[model samples]
Target: MPELLAHRADTEPDRVALVAGDEQVTFGRWHARAGAVAAGLHARGLRPGDRVALHYGTASWHDYAVACTGVLRAGLVAVPMSDRLAPAEVRHVLTHSGATAVLRSAGRPDTDLAWSATLAEIEAEAGGSVPPQPPSPRDLAQILYTSGTTGVPKGVGATHANLAHGCTLDPRRRPLAHSTHFLHAFPVGSNAGQTMLVNALNARAAALTAGTFTPGRFAKLAERYAAGTIFLVPAMAIEMLHAKVHTTHDLSAVRLVGSTAAALPPAVALQLAAAFPAATIVNYYTSTEAAPAQTSMVFDPERPGALGRPTVAADLMIAGPDGRPLPAGEVGDVWLRSPVAARSYYRDGDASAEVFRGRWVRMGDVGRLDDEGYLYLVDRDSDVVKSGAHKVSTLQIEHALHEHPLVREAAAFGVPHPVLGTAVAAAVVADGTLTAPQLRTFLLDRLAGHEVPGRVLFLDRLPRNDNGKILKRELRQLLDDDRATQ
Candidate 1:
């Protein structure tokens, strides 16, 4: 990563590399500041392979960027922890990773973490040059903790090669080169944020983000920067469409719009296409462990639901219950083998063995690839509903619900039933007055009789995790509580 920065500094010293609110840093200045921070960290007794935790909120994104690069420059492993974490959660990461030092912004309350120092403090100690000890391709680079929606968060250790994938600096061959700026609103300590960081080093366009993100603010940035490409999660895309931000802002400069972190709902995907008529609306599907092995699709109006074929750098397949490869259209475990080496959970041999099988990584997602090689994700393995003798996809039901104009958000899961063994149930967030019978009638026109939800409940909002994924387990608990009261 440092090598890439040095190259950019030498070639485009005066070019703008990053823009966060009122701060715009040039490549030459960013390189100098990072080098100084590296020297200061070494002076403070940081050695090669040491783990340094970076804890910062989105508001401190500029400092987070400098701190992350400085850790890499100092030949230490960077461990990024989300500031949204509670004290207990922060302690867990610090203890698990055995971080020797921490870099954070000023004004944040102190934690029980060991040897914390603010960026200002680190800069104050900056002076002497540290001898270069550039990391090899196979050396550890970063340890990213999972969101832990299912259980305790586990750390995914990435090598230099793993994080540096697709970072060729050749301007003529880079992806999305037509864009003057690559705009995103992902918070710090996210996979999407790290991906944007990589773009900052390699892409022809400057990496741009707002200090704070609202639908209106995001649109204005796009207009002000004349951003050519925009990346967002499905939830953010839905918010912008629902709020009608495009009506008030000029987004014609955008040529490509991408969604990741979760599958884009078919209804929302269509709306995005209409809103960005000049842009190519795309959806990317991948996990933190199987990154760079992404399956992406440029939205096809004819096949609005398809996730694109695997790129040249990725090898994807569907494996059945017995672990044998399944034929086309057979829903099973989705596995990916990327040019980047597969990673394991830090300090957890059991999880490493379960998830990493030789060169391939189990994606923990259930999907099928059509004969034409388009991937269609069904649902998370744990969220699939078994009703009677049939297996139903909650994602499909949710897609149907999203087709309704009144439905804003939806989640579907299995509920216990004495007669059918299990029945399909759903909770929806909507603006207008909606009833169970009315929603069922609306679904009847779009879905098969068997595919219709058995119990339809209305709510103001659906429960979501920090990363914007629906919490199906919590939704089921809500159903249980309602059943007990009745």
Candidate 2:
């Protein structure tokens, strides 16, 4: 990573690389600061291969970027965590990664780690040099924890090659090349946010982030910077449309809007296209462990449900119960092959074995491929509701709800049913007055009789993780509590 920075700094010393609110960093300054931070870590007796947890709040984007690259420059491993996470949540990451040191930003989240220092304190000491031995391609680059919608969040480790596999030192070959400024509001510790940081390092465009993400604030930044490319997850996209920020703001400069982290509901895609008519809307599909290998779909009216084919150097396969690759149009486990050496879970042989099959990463999704090989997700294995004699896709139900004019956001899941083993349920966040019967009637038009959610709950907002993925587990708990009160 330092090698790339050094070259970028030498070549385009004054080009702005990062922006957040009032602060910005050029390639030269970022590289120098990163080098200095690398030196500070060395001075503190942290060696190559030692794991360091970076616990930074969303507001500390610049410092976190410097510290992360600096750790890479020092040939050490980085464990990125957001301060927005609870202390227990943060502790799980710190303890699970077996991190020897914890690096914090100014607004540090409290933790009990023995060795901890703020980036501000570390930067105060200016007395070391870049590691002569930068991390090799096979060296562990970073460990990012999953969203933990299931049990505990597990750590996924990516090597330097995994990080740089699809990356080109030349900015011209970088993805989203036709942009002057790239804007996103992904929290710094999430996979989406980490990818944006990588883009700042090598992409032709300068990266922009909001200290705190509000739709109005994000729109203002996009308007102010004239960001040609905007990257975000579906929740943010829905919020932007709900807030109607684009109506008031000049979003005419945006040429491309990329959505990821979860499936972009087809209705939302149409709304996004109408909102940003000048931009091409693309949905990117991949997981933390399966990154660098992804399938991206541009909005096509003809194929609204397709996720896309395996991108440039990536491969996709639908594997059956026996783990053999399934033919097209067959729904099975979705697996993606990374262009670079694939990543694995840290210190968990069982999890790694279940997920990392040979060179392919099991995406934990049930999907099918069209004759043309475009992927269409069926449902997450865990999210599939076995109701009566049918298996229902919660994603399909959620997409159906989103089709309604007043529905703002929706999540569909399964609840226990004495007769059928499980029953379909939905929790919706609506923009205006809506009744359960009206939504159920609306869904009946699009979904099968069994797919219609039997129970519905209305909420002002849906609970989400830092990465903006819906927490269905929490939704189930909420429904249980709501019913108990009734």
TM-score of each: 0.95, 0.97
Q: Could you tell me how far off, in angstroms, the CA of residue 360 lies in candidate 2 after the best superposition?
A: 0.2
Q: Positional deviation of 52 in candidate 1, in angstroms?
A: 1.0
Candidate closest to the true structure, highest TM-score: 2
Provide the lDDT at 194 for model 1: 82
lDDT tens digits, residue span 263-363, model 1: 89989999999999999999998888887678889999788889888875238888997778898989899988877787778999999888888768889
Model 2 agreement with the true structure over 386-442: per-residue lDDT tens digits: 998999999898889999999999999999989999999999888877888888888
Evaluated against the true structure, the overall lDDT of model 1 is: 0.84
